[model samples]
Target: MRQKMLLAFAAGAMLASCGESENAEGPEVADLLFSGGTVYTVDGDATVAEAIAVRGDKILYVGSAEGAKAYVGPNTLTEDISGKIVFPGFTDSHAHLPDGGDTILGLGLGGLTSAEQIVHAVKAYADAHPELPAIMGSGWELNLFPDANPNKALLDEIVPDRPVMLVAADGHNGWVNTRALDLAGVTSETADPVNGRIERDAEGNPTGTLRESAQGLVSHIFPKPAVEDVVRNLEAGLAYQAGNGITATIDAAIMHDHNEAAYLEVSSRQDLPQRVRLSLLAAEEMVTSMVTPDNVEAVVEKLVERRAQFRAQAKDRLDADAVKIFVDGVPENHTAAMLEPYVNAPLGPDHRGEINLSEEALNAYAIALENAGFQIHIHAIGDRAVRVSLNALEGAIETNGERPRRHHLSHLEIVQPEDIQRFAPLGVTANLQALWHFNDAYISELTEPFLQEKLHRWIYPAKSFVNAGARVVWGSDWPVSTSDPFDSMEVAVLRKNPDDANDQSWIPEERLSVDDMIKALTINGAYLMGQEDIRGSLEVGKQADFILVDADPYKVLPEDISDIRVLRTYIGGRQVFSAAE
Candidate 1:
């Protein structure tokens, strides 16, 4: 679904086989037929077929090209896709959609390669929008700067008169100019808020970098993106997901953050491009204050009722059944709840970071929510947060007894070895962003030095989780990173940047096979979305959600995986994207 035309397949073998099948016996006439190429079903046994027939939105046939001919009729739309590599339409388990959409509409910084370009871009954007009180945008990398720290001075060089606020590509940190910081009244004297930091210099002067929750200090001053703009942007975001071959996703933080309005707007038009799962944000206070043993059932009852009510209005495309909870912050800011003190504890020597909720509160909410039938999508980045979440899941099982649930923990950034095995037995999914598994310049400059050797080594154990029998799934966490599925697939298999051949595999031992990575992106992610049965694989009865790639990933070089192009994307047998178009 990515945007790019690739007539890369051999001109001879490429499309020679997309003709009607010779077998003419079956009564089931296919509405559409694709023949003479490899079709990776990603089914239970991982069936690979030479042809596929679609009748309406469901797959009508998948078998040898000759066998598929039986399902073809006079009116069937057939394609000779012999040269293409077919795959299931992808699913992004964790993405901030409306926000991802909004970033694209902002200063448009994602494609810029240098800091100088960013400074000029900001200045140009500021000059053009003088009526705006402040400028805000995202998509800047951290490794481009010294110590992964971006000072406000760069923006000051261009727009010293206006306030400029921009976030890092990861969305975990923020950089602002002095005018913006001053408008927020954030100075050396301003104390770091809970679960955040205001990076300072040797003299304790604000360095213009805000980590985690500290971004909020400057956020309040910027004009909110109008509701209409947000809706259009969100609609654009869903199309972007489709462009990346993503047909489904859990918009990680939706309704609770006021994204529901935009989602409802899209649904009302019946223009939703993908199957979206609305993971309503559960405020930290919801667990810390609202849920207790005395009122746990009552709070859960109300939450379930609200979810049912929202679902009734959201239409079939957007489902509201999951709750997103943040257990801790990211490792880059030292706000991630670690089991032990950091190697360089700038906050304090004894500080080991803290969780957003108490153990008792998390336990109560998880149990009640599970019993009430809500999918819990937990953001557990630090080791302690991972452990705390596992404990909560364990308590949920002990209380309600193990049952079917798509409950998952996203961003298992650091999972202790002892707790790694707990996911599978607990039926918990390891919702991973493998794109961040590499040991990059940012890690060397900012994160590695701050983590204990053992903890640092435990980063992104995708293989360990897979080996531990845990249900492994992949998520883009877009706006934080690129949503290109192949990029993450390459990282999961190589554990390094696919573009840099010289880069060492960060942890070669933990690398997964290509097949495992594919399953994680396809079936596993669908499992997390609670649509595996109907949407994940290309089974006969399943919805025809699949993609066609220009080259076979299995036949390509390990590092060249990301370069493979998605030629087309289909959902429910309906073509959603075509690179050639």
Candidate 2:
């Protein structure tokens, strides 16, 4: 009779009980229950809960610790997370996961300070890997070199026999040896591609440096990684992100067809540690040649077919609902399009940088993508690039009407005040790389002179965007920057590099609050990925994706936030990463 009563109560409450008879029915007993921690829901109210119960992959309960006890039963695993802070699993809105993984597995050149160091490292790597067909690596910063430009002469002196190409930290430029240039048939007569530049000497000879689209000349000839290698690298990258409390990420640029196939294979095997959304590269020609009205339709058709193919292949875990377009290059290289002339242009004062796509082409492409039900993710770093992207989005809206999907504008380094106000009204997301908010070597030494008086004011405007009611999401742009969300959060909040004692806030007014930063990393990111309703916060019906940290970021000093490490990360109620393990 007691068992019957208990079963009735459970059924009435819609709670599942473990070890119940086959005849018994209820909602199955929670497989796991986490209690005694400060649970940050990050919901609309930013509510705090004391306990949460999970059944299968969904949260079954979230309320008082005592109330959670009712759902506990045999076969249930309960953890007492006393003194720990629990948060919704972080989501990286922008990242190159596969490429970052490849960097880790290959020659990691992320932090070398000089050209000499790069040469030594490259030589050591080359000597160790004589079997490689072509040498390729990334992560060289322009500020470390004299004149902020790396020439072929340095590379030729070290590895003149073989082709070698090293990418800049930002991935916007490529530095190669003379052999690489020669192998790609890039010569002084090679007319500058539509949106790319081949740096040349005074005598019109190729200098072995390529910017933007021109990098494709050498990159296309480079041997592609095997499918197994790509899968291995992607797994490594996903593990790194999970260890840092990231539960989801978007591969900002899915470049090759092989990359898409690898991603589909991984998702099929359920080996992916975190949720992944892929943004297929739509403007490949713009990167190598140019986007013209003549080829715009062909490009759109290709993107549409690719999207359908990927979606049909991996219908469950894969999301190919977005397309990536590189509107302009980086500011440090003076390639990012701008409204006003650059203060220190290599060509002349009249040079305001170059736009990768014409206005008509951009408009047509954006409209076509939107009409096909794809979210547009544009890379716009400069003020003029941002404005042009906005104009394209506006045209798309005028053509197709407003859609449910919120488009994104990433790497917002130089948004004008007028453009800042346009974000909310246009329903566009400000996908910001908050890690670059501080005065880093790139900003101080390489880019400052070019901006002149607009230095601080033109940087990331996080606070201003939020105040204007724009939806803001944060990303690391990993491989270009650190993938740790806490590191980015600290920089976002303090507006200064946490590692540099001498550094001051670059733009004090742009600093975000702890609450705002948390939301940006969690809920806002989920919204950007179109998964807000499923896993953004700790709700009764949402997916059980959350993490346990060593300390509460809200209670710690702003500067100490980055020191608060993630002890465990959970995705779909499964412990995928643990610091103890």
lDDT of each: 0.79, 0.81
Can you give the TM-score per candidate against the true fold?
Answer: 0.90, 0.93
Candidate 2 per-residue lDDT, tens place, 1-581, comes to: 00110101111112122111111564456899888887888766556777888888888887677777877889899999986988999999899887788889997789787778989999999989999878899988788876566889988887888899898888888899989988889888899876778888899988877888888888777887889888888888899899989999988988646677678767665545788888888655323324577887777778778777766666454678888988888888788888888787687889888777788888888888887888889999889999999999988888887568689999998889989999999999999898888888777776777875764586778899999899999888998888888888888987887887557777899988777788888999999988999988888778889999988777776777778889999998889899972
Q: Which stretches of candidate 1 lie over 4 Å from their true place?
A: 1-26, 111-113, 202-204, 269-271, 284-306
* Error in Å for residue 283 of model 2: 3.6
Candidate 2: residue 553 Cα off by (Å)? 1.0
lDDT of 1 at 378: 91
Cα TM-score of candidate 1 = 0.90
Off by over 4 Å in 2: 1-28, 285-290
